[model samples]
Target: MTFDLRPWQLADFPAYQALITAPAIATAIGIDAKSTVSQQQAFENDLYQTYQAAILIDGVPQGSIVAYQRANELGEPLVNEADIAYFLSPAFWGHGIMTDVITAFIAQLPPHFTLWADVLADNIGSLRVLEKVGFTNHGTYIDLFGRQIIQFHLYR
Candidate 1:
């Protein structure tokens, strides 16, 4: 299967909504599965402000990947560091699609930047993907939502 990544567009909203609201995907990303249309719209708008892209398979969006400035405990953005995140449709899971997508995404980033990712401790799939792509485990913590999270980082 041919894979590509590109900036999200207005036309992707419907697919984006569907992707994010799926129970497994929503829980993984901290999005409420029962969120209203307006709430989802707001969330989508916020994502558009970040450095994000649609993961396309044979020219159809199947998932998304994004990197945004990391924030300090006090909510200030960090220089030269970004927190990366991604999600793929359930149908695409376990096919090495995300591993390939993330590898390509990291390759295009500025060499001076450091990338971080926080995965729910129970998210074994994502943890493996990060490791396969060269991210180091920095240990774990309980997030604000009370979820056990594992932190990983890659320094270019």
Candidate 2:
């Protein structure tokens, strides 16, 4: 299957919403399963401010990958470090689409920066995807929702 990554457009919101709201995707990413429209709107607003891209398969958006600067407790951005996050439609899971997307995305990023990804401990698929892309386990921590999160990082 041919795929491409491009900046998100307003028209992609519906596809993005569907991917993010999928039961497995929402739970793994800590999004409320019953998220309100306002909440989704707010989330979409935040996406526009970050380095985000829509993953298109046959010209339709089926996934997303984003990177945001890491922040300290004081809300200061950390230099040369960023946190990466991504999600794919459940229909496209188990096909290695995410692995290929991430590999391509990382290739286009500045090599001096370090990219970090936090995966819910129970998200075996995501954890494996990170491993496949050369991200090493950095540590683990508990998220606000009290879920076990494993941190992985790669030096580009």
Indicate the residue-level lDDT of 27 in model 1: 85
lDDT of 2 by residue, 47-144 (tens): 67467888899898888888888889999998878889988888888899899999999988877989999999988999999999999999999999
In angstroms, what RMSD does candidate 2 have relative to the true structure?
1.7
Clashes of 2: 0
* Model 2 spans > 4 angstroms off: 38-42
| Model 2: lDDT to the true structure | 0.84
lDDT by residue (tens digit), candidate 1, 25-96: 888887777777754664465367457889998788888898888789999988879989899999989899
lDDT of 1: 0.85
lDDT of each: 0.85, 0.84
Compare the candidates by TM-score and give the number of the best one.
2
Residue 145 of model 1 has an lDDT of: 95
